[model samples]
Target: MKSPQALGLALIAALALSACQDKAAAPEDIRPVRYIVAGGQAEIGGDSYAGEIRARNETQLAFRVAGKVAAKLVNNGERVKKGQPLARLDPSDYQLDLAAKQAQLAAAESDLAQQQLNLKRYRELLAKQFISQAQVDAQQNGVNAAQAKLKQARAALDASRNQTGYATLAADADGVVSQVQAEPGLVVAAGQPVAKLSQDGPREVAIQVPENALDAVRRAGGFRVTLWKGGAPLEGKLRELSADADPATRTYPARIALSGDSRSLQLGMTAAVALPARASGELKLPLTAILDLQGKHYVWTVDDKTLRVSRKPVEVASIDSDGASIASGARAGDKIVTAGVHLLREGQRVKLLGQ
Candidate 1:
């Protein structure tokens, strides 16, 4: 028979051993994580910019002469041909000025004819010895002065005629009137925009690019434009890029010319331009996936078979609003943990959120 003190000691040892076994058999903590598949069908490191479909050539139409607008001949979105009347100014003042010039020209012609007759008479008198050579010379000088005055008057008359014709504003090319800025009663200065015209021709996509992406945009091979209303992506070539940033938006305005069959594109249609990635064949991951320890960068990659998370050292080429571009360490079709990266450890068992 065992002693009471020995029985107590045995009981205590058994309880301790049971506790140890329970702890050893317990399951490990499995962290649930969100992950992304790298290098899928979507191109990594590329960018998309919202833009608008616009005519390759848009012009602000204005009158050559300042006057009170008498009539606006074209409405918004109206198509006009070259030399077609677009708007008209009040012709009352111009007509009166033309009449005055015409009257002055008539007076000058009458004076010139009278002076020529006098010169002829003076020469005849000199030939007959009735008048001195000095008198004939004076009459000839008067005729020459009259002729010069007549030419001046005629030139003034021609200018007046042109001014009268200018009272009616005409379209310089075939286009659609996108906007009208003047009313019939408004008095506008010469060269002040009265309407906006979109010339008929090839179309372009107008996009605003940030300063940081200017180099990428310049180096891109080409662009693909997709309309907001849905259509096949159209190929585009960079046509114009503003050297100076826009004061209001602080973005560089860029125009991408569309190639092949842009006739269906209308002005002001919203679109998006896809800019190619700066570097090709590189994996891209979310910024959250990047784990920064000290000065080095790392990502949490998942094992396909074991579903274990491992810390991966990666080389980041660049980081932007889109995400981070992985230059090395990660490749296409690799699964990466995008969330809860800071709490994860190497070889930690993980449960994919959607799996």
Candidate 2:
């Protein structure tokens, strides 16, 4: 047998040899992705905004009278039509108040009748010389006062009945209930928001865009907005751009008007607005094709007919519905690497997938 020191050196040498073999087994070149250079007229030159699909009319539904919510008939996200009852409040208190008003009105009418009778008696006494004319006038004045009170009481009863109607919440316009704030048996104050309704109207794409994008949007150019839903893209027109940036976000809100079946679109749907009008000679590619190495965005470029691939840093101009519009650092005649970019390093050799 060998000495103890020699045996230890042999074991270390064997491990080193195995590591070298494993390294040799790995591929030297990274396979690059092939791209088709189809030179067609691209219509992506517009102010692309990153926005969401939002309802045009969003109204807050509320109760007119202060009462406990007795029954909430509609659930959140339910569709409601005009004049439809969405919620009911406890009307017991209002009912009792109306009844009291009715009783008061009745009492006022009875008093008016008694005053009329008294006035008639006074008139007869004055005519028979048993009472003075002034006494008759005073009784007639009392009758007049009672009549006025009865009229006022009647109006009060009518007003109380109107208040009772407030216990039932009605939808003033057609819309979808975006949010339900009132719950069954919850007491809410008058004019308090019970639900948020998104009215049925033209949809808009609201996006928070950077301040630099504001100038481009105001230049009055044809912009395109795309809604990605269920793998099918819905196109829209960039209708309005904000005049100023939001104070809190430091970004401008760009709105896009959606067309055709806006009813199917709901609020807060993720959307992409492509603003590639400012981009000149930039290639539009999928966001997945981008890579980040040391905080820099890169993409893999493949060599034709060879298994080797190269990594290149691309300047992303803007990202919208289609993908990222590359402004610089990539060209139409270039081959990009897509697979395994995160694991790739500079000067790494890769093989094309089908080569």
Candidate 3:
């Protein structure tokens, strides 16, 4: 019903409107990610490690002689002194036996005197040829037997005294009573833990490390300690490293002695042991550089003048307050993605954030 020119114009307008609607209907595309490139010149400080306080000398105090635990003078945590009587044993029997031994010793002494007098008489009689030589020899034998008996009695008395003395628990050194296993009237076996004496001294922080880290620790040179009580971070050295690995965990125990005893340092206080890692040679990137893809560790880096992320196998050397210290799998001048890496994949295009 319209003219040819009008129809042509309407057709062109409808085509243009259709093109506009098509463009509007299209979904919005995601924007490229931007990342910051950082240099690896920083010192990869020590990473945090869980640690505990331990006593270098934890002694288990025990009784030498087996007896009924008669008196418990001090309970756990009770202060004791050297040669201080912690408990007493039932000494009535030992005392009686000791007295009997003394009596026996006295009898032996009397018999020895009599034998000596008899020997003297025999010798004088033999000299005058009034008695046989065999008689004098018999008197001499009696004197020797009496002397042996006296020795035996003395030994028995000494043993009784030792057994009686062992009943009391004495402090070997000045320490706080950590534990008390024996109670009053409780029969305890010999050499059993009657008490635990915790020696007094400045406390230290201890930590357990994996065997793989032994070499890393040595190369790292020194370590730093950050007390969990929020005290000032202190520098310390690696005091010890167990040569043998723990069978249960296959980890080695590393003890770090704090430089100075801080007031907040308490026995059994938890701490974090961080070692300076960046100073030691390693690929150190920002914290955001680490990326995990399907159970594998990697980082996004620039390559070929394009932001292309690739799988980089990195051995975590240490974790510091600044960033992580990578043992390997990266080198200097590698541009690592600092943000938006979670949604990234191998060979994915990336634009530096805030660039």
Candidate 4:
């Protein structure tokens, strides 16, 4: 019903109204974030390290001679006393060797006796001037050679007897059989472990500690071990510490000797070792505060008066549950944005909540 000029004017008015509404609905440019002042150092309880129970004197019992295993005298977990027989090899070969050496010795003895009789007869003949001196001297030489052969044979017999005795493997100390490596009818070589014996003595807890915590562990005046099952804490002392770090884990292997009664502890039990963790002189920030820009690490630090955020480049020493420990680029009293860091731009204004 309106004319062309009137319709155009109305359309312009509507457009102006929509533009005003859009301006009113525009989002705020400043962002709100939560941050923590980095000054107060974090409190850390003793570092927990996982370890296993072991024996101080774990021994491996092996055979001294190569042969087929004829008998296994003890089973796994069996208690044994010193000099107890744990396994035996087939003695047939060793016994036959001994018999052969004995026979050779007896023959040598008989030869020596005959040669002595000949020497005596030669001496008598020479005294009567019935035989030449050279003939008598030859008989004496034969007697001396026969006696040397007898001595050599006797020495070989002793060695053969020792070999026969070696066929039986015996425990060197009081222990409990923890493992069996061979069985009856299985052939084993000399020095091959047939069983593992855990000697009945001091108990040890073996653990691998990170290189960073090694110095703190060494300086710890005392130690305590608690079972993973939540048993009473057992007093402990460092028994052995490895000088070299493990190549794969980059950790040092150490052992703690348990004091008092360790009868409740079992082999292969999981344990947690509590060691004092002092301030490592590193600033720990929340993991959310760290932002990776390219290959470098960054965080948003809030200004005290301006309430503006500035991007801070920080070097992280270690990352754990507490957060990332900063090695540099951040000081003890700096304020770092913990949340909504990605949405913030450098030099942008921000409102600190609970300020």
Candidate 5:
């Protein structure tokens, strides 16, 4: 019933609407990219490692003789001077042993005295022909044996007395008790640790270095420390480094001595250590960002304003464990694409992540 012109016009309008809808439904062509700004010179900084403040000397205080602990005189964190009593063992047994030894020594001395008088009388009797020379000699021998026994007994007594003295635990140096392993009423063996002492001396920072960074750490020029509570950057120097790696952590233990204004440093306080990393001549880049096409290496660099990437051919230098060194074509501060090198074409638009 409608006219032919009206029908054609309606068809045209419907086709135009469909074209506009299809255009609106098209997806965005921008590629998501991750990039890093290259560094021209390899300067190591901003690497902070968690460490602990420690004294220069840490000693394990142990008893020299085995006994049941009687009383703990000083507890953990107690400060003590040299020869200070830390704990006491039950001295009842030691005292009893000492008394027995003393009694034995006294009896031996009495026997020795009696033998000497008898030997003297035997010599006089021999001179008067009342006893044979053999008899006199035998009496002299008896006296010598008694004297030997007395000496042995005296030595035993001294040993027993020393054992009695060992019942009291004493600090060997001025220090602060860091750990207490034995308490009153606990039986401990000889040379078993009863407490740990942090000796009064220089302070240092202890840190663990991973195997990959071990060489760099050893070659570090110096170190700096910052306390966890926040303070000025204090100077530090490497004092000790382990020759072998730890079995469990595979890390090497290193000690850095605190140099300036370290009076406020406390033991066991958490700290951060920054060691200067040795710089190499060439610049470093992520190994994944490097693409090898027909033996020629290339890296995709991004333009800041256009957000577009262009493949730049680069000469390969020595490759490192973490990244490859750029010999030529790329310099520091240049923005380079780190991901999806093969999928990206030259001059393609990209949307930076988190931008």
Candidate 6:
């Protein structure tokens, strides 16, 4: 036999060798991970803008001629028909001016008749050799001048008549007077807005969109408009979009035309317009599921059969508070690792935490 110290050393070596063998034979680590289904009904958060209901054909009513407003025929919110008088200006000055033009026209007509008679007499004298050819020609020229003056006077009289009629501002179309800017005794210039008329036609919603969301708004398939006074949501289509941003607000003004049962919608009603997210059919996932490496975006997807995690490159469309909208590289029913994405490796076996 060996000495006691040697025996102890040999035993220790054998114990260490057995421990190494046991460690080598141990089972592989199976990491538990939190995961989620790639494709579901989850949608990225969309944008909403506060808007106002308005007529699609709003117009500013104004007088064609400058004058003092004598009377305002219609008040605010009054329904008016085409050709209905909205306001009246003082007719005293216009009437007096019309009278002056009429007098001038009468004088011109009388002068023209006298000139024609003188020209006929001169022609007769020339035929009888009682007057020279030049004299007859001069009389003809005088008649021509009188005829021109008569035509000018007639045009002036017509213009004056039109001015007098313009003293009464009338509605151009059937509409409701939304605003009355000119009151009785207020002097207004030509083309100044006296009232605002909302024509009876299709109703629309006007909304302001920020510059950052303009692209999404433009690409949206449709919109939903909800009224503030509690009514069913109305379907809407984008009708118009401003190319330039508003200088003061730095927002783009857009108009959405409402469809189906807009009769109850009135002008100036507050509303909200919902703009859907741009990526319609793309899959969405939590932001934590995505991994950024080497200036590229990727995600850890788990295999269904093997339960193995693998890095997948994905095309990211947009990221918001809701989640990341994936454009490609992932499909419906694929398991995606939501938590511990960075710790996972390619082809590594994993156990779903919840499952």
Q: Choose the strongest candidate by TM-score.
A: 1
Error of 3 at 197 (Å): 0.9
List the candidates' TM-scores in order.
Answer: 0.93, 0.60, 0.73, 0.68, 0.81, 0.73
Total backbone clashes of candidate 6, pairs 3 or more residues apart or in separate chains? 0
Off by over 4 Å in 6: 1-42, 277-281, 285-323, 326-355
Residue-level error in angstroms, candidate 1, position 276: 2.8
Clashing pairs in 3: 34-351, 34-352, 34-353, 35-352, 35-353, 43-278, 44-277, 44-278, 46-274, 46-275
- Residue 189, model 4, lDDT: 93
- Summarize candidate 4's per-residue lDDT along 37-110 as a digit string, tens digits: 77453433467788999989998888989999999999998989999999899999999999999999999999
Give one digit per residue, the lDDT tens place, for model 2 in 130-160: 9999999888899999999999999999999
lDDT of candidate 1 over 1-355, digit per residue (tens) = 9999999999999999999999999999899998888886443646889999898889998888889999999999999999999899998998999999999999999999999999999989999999999999999899999999999999999999998898888888998999997789999898899998899999999999999989889988899888989978899989999999999999999999999989678889999899865454667778988999998999898998999988889999989877888889888878888898999999999999941
lDDT of 3: 0.73
Q: Which digits, one per residue and each the tens of the lDDT, describe model 5 over residues 263-318?
A: 46788899989876436444678788898899999999889898888999998787
Per TM-score, what order, best first?
1, 5, 6, 3, 4, 2
In model 4, the runs with Cα more than 4 Å from the true position are: 1-47, 131-137, 209-224, 235-254, 259-264, 280-355
lDDT of 2 at 195: 89
What TM-score does structure 3 among the candidates reach? 0.73
lDDT of each: 0.89, 0.75, 0.73, 0.87, 0.86, 0.89
| Residue 52 alpha-carbon offset, candidate 1, angstroms | 1.1
> Can you write out model 3's per-residue Cα lDDT over 1-355, one digit (the tens) per residue?
8999999999999999999999999974433665544444343445657887655555798999887887877887666666677777777766787788889888988998999999999999999999999989988999999999989988988988887778778888766677887787888888888888766655566788876567767666666777677767787678788888889988888777667764345566677777775543455677777776666667766664755667677766766545676777777666666776777677765555553
Judge candidate 5 at residue 194 and give its lDDT. Answer: 87
